[model samples]
Target: MYRLKPGIKQNPQRRWELPDRIFFGHGACHILAGTYLEIAPLKGFHAERIIPGDGFAGNHIFVTDGEIAFDFHGYSLRNKLLLHHTSGWARVSDPGWYCRIEDVDFNLLDTRALNARKMLGPDQYFGDPRIRARSFLERIDHIDSVKKLARNVD
Candidate 1:
């Protein structure tokens, strides 16, 4: 028989609801995927940054309006992972896979500092960061492959 892992449970009432409008300038948007996001240029004149160790609890889903270049727990990557209408961004570390919304331009709003303070919180899980990183990297690889295939067909 198989058993569920600790902190992993099936919610009978789980649902997925996409927001009507997920654009920049919106305060904080909550999604059905258990992620909370805020747009860039949060409230100051600096680029927003999310450090996993700084009280950033739970899995976050961020969509940046502009390119976000940073190193996740030491792994460096340039560019935002997710994009949407609101120019919102996230910094999550959950083990589950997340949906990716594509085709949005990056914003250079100077609210990163303020948004950092407001957005920083305790994460729900601190499982293996490598596992989560690998998952995201795999997704990125898959996206790149699809894009290359499309280009080849064209």
Candidate 2:
């Protein structure tokens, strides 16, 4: 059976207030999504990198499998995830949301996600966002099939 995990707690009241690590919702979507793209496959899950589709401008990125999306806020339905975007930046349903990154295309998205690592500046407690993501996964009870991924990864 597939298990759904509650979304990761985001700093909704105070952005960037979490001093110990780069807060996932605070311009760190790329980092979180990029981490999943790299790690999920190794654990036998398929993850696709995505960005907002045409006519919408967004600074966020996430991973999905055409149904659930994994981002700084953990796993959630793709549309449900967008509803939580109350920051008044992007309108809901604008540009029809999510566009997939083709495998053949030059991935400026991944490059940006990778480049985001250096921009954390003083918030980089764990040295890298991917490391922080792993730490987050280890402590949380996410999907059922991959519950052991963190402990099992070498």
Q: Judged by lDDT against the true structure, how good is candidate 1?
A: 0.27
Off by over 4 Å in 1: 1-83, 87-116, 120-124, 139-143, 149-154
Model 2 over residues 62-99: C-alpha lDDT tens digits? 56665555666566665666555422334444544554
Q: Once superposed on the true structure, which residue ranges of model 2 sit more than 4 Å away at CA?
A: 1-22, 41-57, 86-126, 145-154
Quick one: RMSD of model 1?
15.1
State every prediction's TM-score relative to the real structure.
0.22, 0.50
Query: How many clashes show up in model 2?
Result: 0
All models: lDDT? 0.27, 0.48
Q: Per-residue CA lDDT of candidate 1, range 45-117, in tens?
A: 1223322333333222333324332122111122423232112323233443234333223231223532454
